[model samples]
Target: MKASHFLFFILLLCICIPASAQEAKMKKIFNGKNLKGWVEPANKACWTVSDGVLLVKNEPAKKGAILWTEKSYQNFIFQADFMMGDGTVDSGIFLRSENDQIQIGISGSLKRDLTGSPYIPKLRYPVEATGVKDLLKPKDWNTLKIKVIGNTYTAYLNGQEVMTYSSADMPPSGPLGIQLHPGNEMSISYRKIMAVAL
Candidate 1:
């Protein structure tokens, strides 16, 4: 063809290549059928899979549990859709380690919905998430997206940028975890759990 057309074609290919490569990096961490990649807890009855959604509830004794991934991740983008269930729904997504977590439902200590906020051990909530009051849907499904790079954590709720925090004490690498806060007698459902390494 013409020289100008050939040059334009090459430029388009360069731009499209990176976009396609990035999409391929994303993988489904949860198979939606079973807990194959996660480290199963002793109380299997507390966690269940139904209709491709992973449901978590407190055991009969009210003891909480954490469903953690077997593999540890460094810097990545994690996304999941969660629906708040019955009772005092206090749950979170633990990043890197249990020390740094993103609150999903009510805060046990604060006794209020702290959804989309970062909960750090010892330091508690260093900063509250903005627009969480309006962004969170009480009984419906909400999307949570977390981007982790080094010590900084950025959170998006329902596709809106909600909060960002930097932790000096965050572990460099650790497995991700979903928490069913102990003694809450709460329940939550999670689906479309995915992550992309950066």
Candidate 2:
């Protein structure tokens, strides 16, 4: 083979190798068929899967539900598509268990749309995300991506960087969870859930 062709081949190989490896590192935590790798802290009836979407519905008869991952992660990137059914739906994506969470919908009483905000429940207040109000789709699906590295947390909404925060009290490792706030009658759906551990 020609020297120029050989050099070009080597360059392509180098670029493709890492991209392939990075893709391989990602693991799909949710299977569309069932709740195989998740735990419902409250009850099974609160959570359900249908037609490739994971639905968390508020149950008036039961307490608030949190669906947690079976496996824990230290540093990882989470990707998912979420949408609210209707009205004011309160929900969030819990990081490293229930201590830390990223707000996905509105909060009750406060009536604030804090999507993309990184907050510590029952502890510190939420750090509001910028450019989130314009990006959020109330009646449509929105893409969310979160990257947690050590104490740093970064969030992206609809392919745009929404916010980044650092916390000293962040846990070293834990499972991720999706919350279904009780009391109010609301429903939230999630699909294409995946994670890549770093």
Candidate 3:
């Protein structure tokens, strides 16, 4: 009805544009309600979710890895907050497929002397760890951020630079998986998993 009021309304609409645009650009891979389009390792009792958090109950002496998302991503930044327990736990965030590709995982504090097989990144990182979690408290939450671009990856744990390296050339596309290694009495929790495309 008034010019100044109209101008103020237009300004308000413009101010909200970028905020909504940013939200729209981000893709939430996990629904946080339940597992959908995701896969769990056969006979795995280690993975669960509560209070918007995915919980992996510690199981010992047998690998109980789980892969959460069915869809794959390339050139993205993945961020997750984790809380893990004792008894030397080792887990990883896998990129591209259940049967192929690289993984970013924990070493030391967890005392995981991981030996890789004929896996993709394993060929390049045989027995080498990309991340270490000594700074993470046994009973507290830790933040993790990983950047993946064309087989090159960098990971940060608890705001510390834990790893940075590049693997062999991959397919340039595929899904993502979350893995919980066996041989530890560790309860692992993950939430606020956010990813952005590059």
True-structure RMSD, every candidate: 3.1, 3.4, 7.4
Residue 25 alpha-carbon offset, candidate 1, angstroms: 2.9
Give the alpha carbon lDDT tens digit for every residue of 1-198 in model 3. 899999999999999986566546666666687776676666456767667888876655556666667666888777788776555556667766544433333453334433111135345343343334355455777777776778777667777765666666555777677777555566667888777777
Tens-digit lDDT track for model 2 on 57-163?
87767367888899999988998999888546888889887778888888664678888987785654557889998899988999999989998999999989999
**Candidate No. with top TM-score:** 1
Model 1 worst lDDT run, 10 consecutive residues: 18-27
What is the Cα-based lDDT of residue 104 in candidate 1? Answer: 92
Comparing 1 with 2 on TM-score, the higher-scoring candidate is 1
What is each predicted model's overall lDDT from 0 to 1?
Answer: 0.92, 0.85, 0.62
The number of the candidate with the highest lDDT is 1
**Global fold similarity of model 2 (TM-score):** 0.86
Candidate 2: how many backbone clashes?
Answer: 0
Model 2 lDDT, residue 46, Cα: 76
Q: Please state the error at residue 3 of candidate 2 in Å.
A: 16
The local lDDT score (0 to 100) that residue 65 gets in candidate 3 is 65
